[model samples]
Target: MKRLGLILLLLIGGFSVKASYKQDTTIVEFTDRGVKKRVTVYTSSKKDFELPRNLNLENVLRSMGVDSSERKKALVLIEQNGAKQDTILLLANDGRTVKIVAKDARDQLSRRDTLRNDSDHWSRSGRNNDDDEDDDDTTTYVKPKKKNSGGRFFSKSDFGFYLGLNNWANGASTVPSLQTWGSRFIALSFRRNATLINGKQMDLALSYGPEISWNNFMFEGNDYIDRSTEQVEFLVATKDLNKSKLVETSLNLPVMFNFGFEEAKLKIGIGGYVGYRVGSYRKLKYSDSRRKEINRDNFGLNDFRYGLTVEIGRRRGISFFGRYDMGDLFKSGQKNAAGLQAWTIGIRL
Candidate 1:
């Protein structure tokens, strides 16, 4: 009777042990938004609790009640045993589905080594046969890092120089012949760019800032820019028209809408600018004695200038720009120059 009793007791003990091993499970609990969610992960054996090799992180996120649209901005914290890892969900490079990307910690261990160490620790803990007791290991939770959105605002600044061919249009009379090579316009600007729409493959931006524009109109005829009368008068000089030039300077405010395409390889900007005249003057050179004269006067130029501006080119490469003034070049007092307007076209550097 004693021998029979001992055999039955051993069988009962073996069955209890097997049932306990089969009941081992891992419960993961987290909060998404304001809702609480829980998931149960079953282990294949008591000695090992491994997630499936083809586990889909996106599906896990969805199961946790995360909204599909908000998933891209969501961060996931995974804790196993005592080790913790932070991951972010992102669209795959092919743009077909979502994937997990580990936010690397500052530890010196390689990713493979870290994961291996974690698995080894869990395996060792399981072999100790302490499944019924609560684990004393401290739970580590990794916090997500903040991202820089860099939206359209005071985020970035740019500086550039522009050189353009200058010309003038007159409706009352024939346009004066100009020294095309010497007639030039130049501008220097400091612009602040704000991103309006930051798309995955393209970006739309707006830039506005202070600019200084200088217009130099070189004439072929022997003419003098008369500030007193606000008009040009023919001059009789022993020497031919060696040099006849009128210069105008203004402080301008330019705003532009920029479209960047092909990963910013190509860019186009269309905008307008308004400026207030700051200074004006005339310079003349005589051929007989090669004498030069500088007259610092308003030269009857308009007090304000406004224009339409355009730019197109490769990013950080040579670009072409054009500006057509809508305001008259000279004030209304000049009879024949009532419809005179200035325009420029050139390359930017």
Candidate 2:
């Protein structure tokens, strides 16, 4: 029994020694004043530390507004030999027993060491430190990555088509000067997008294409038709002379600016365009006042027009829109003539 007890005691003693663990620690020193202050850091968790970490000391320095280059100069390694690993960092605030604790593990120390090395190397070569954890607010310049610089790509281009109703002016001398609207005009257009200033601030677009238009105008004054030479009854001839359709085709160009609101969903812009009349439709009808079948033809008026456009809409790859135009389509002396204008709603892609 005595021999068995001795063996059991020896086994117990062996187990106790194997189970015991001593943690590693560090001491970092810096001058706060003429007095030397020592910062003791505990590394008890370091022995089991696996490195190549996701963290670093640069991030820590940046958060505290510390110069990483200067901080790296103060780092030092101390050998603890067999002493109990002082895993506790005690800063002597005063001279005696009152100490402030700064705790760090092996993983954190490893991260710090990597950051300090990078900073020191950067300072020696006059290069910016690339440590993830070490950021200096004092840095005034940061070189951007190459990919951040703009490159050529068709992904930024724009293209779209729109359809709208237009009005052509009827320039009649006797009619109300402000009454320019005549007949329904149909228009088709294509546009290209330009640069985008900020994510949501400003945009410029350009559009152009062709339009088909029709309008009518009439005027009958005693002086316009000589009274003495008028042979037929006035009432019958006047009705035929005052009514006819004028058709026009034109090529147009427009430049527009888009101002966005509500995260680029809502926008409004104003622009202007000039249209060249490519051709016209000529028709003949009876003149009632002349009391005879007479051909009515006026082909000199529809030549060129210039006008303004205003648009407003919501833009989300597709846009709902409205437009207005203000210009004259006929030459000054041409009777009962007006310009080109339209109100439209359309989408953008």
Candidate 3:
């Protein structure tokens, strides 16, 4: 250690540096005042270039080589590729600096590129302590391990579709008598997730996003919503209809807090959502070769609705979701034969 320190001191103090063989990087650790610091030097052509002979780091950083001086020195690592070179540097608020200077004899770095990229890379405003944690924070070229775990319901973020079936659960009246297979539900949404806890057993995350959903309720019988009354009413169509359905479009916001089990990437979440009806209408198709009929209105449906949601399945793959909206499907205080609330179940991607 003493010999290496003497060698670095001599090299930094405008002396000389010599090594037996070429290496990619040389790491040095030192202390300035109470803080610990580290320097890592690299080279462009490890086999061809010589250190200290080509680098005058003291002049570039305005640092001193004396142990008594608080002006800490840094490491310089250079890499060359064709006409361009890369200089690695550390940016910390403290005096410690690490720089990489790349050589490009044919095509020098533009002044704009130097000022924009290298300057930012070389200088930062943060504490510079001798602690490895502190120095590591100021400079790290390590790439994170990418995870393929961003699924429909468990992910850092995702945008996709949810497709499934629509039906009314816990309904006393007959407002939404939907066909078993004809009623369709779909949601287009972007989900954002934040991890709250991560461990060997499980990881918990909160997810939320805006959703635009469409629900088509196809009546099992020849009935459609009547538009004249203040209360919701199911009216039998005068003609023999091939298809009768009511379509509802809603803008919703849902939040879910989920626990992801480490094994199988399994996840489960329970959350609720609030939504506003954006548009609603009814349609009828005749048995004859007649085009579909259309009528647009609120149809006594509630404009604002809230509901509970459940999500469970593989984190990066298929998932099942269920949603149930609360309260009557109409304005409060209105009475109709069928009082119904909407529910949906489907696969999410």
Report the error of model 1 at residue 166, Å.
Answer: 0.6
The sequence of per-residue lDDT tens digits that candidate 2 reaches over residues 306-326 is: 666666665545455454445
TM-score pick, better of 2 and 3: 3
lDDT of each: 0.59, 0.35, 0.59
Question: Model 1, range 147-189, lDDT digits (tens) per residue?
Answer: 1234221246888898888998764554456788989999999
Report the Cα lDDT for residue 328, model 1. Answer: 94
- For model 3, the run of ten residues with the poorest summed lDDT: 44-53
For model 2 the local lDDT of residue 107 reads 23
Per-residue lDDT of model 3, residues 52-119, tens digit only: 21123432233212131222333212211222433344332342333333344335444533534422
Candidate 1 at residue 34, lDDT? 26
lDDT over C-alpha atoms for residue 99 of model 1: 22
Q: By summed lDDT, which 10 consecutive residues of candidate 2 come out lowest?
A: 90-99
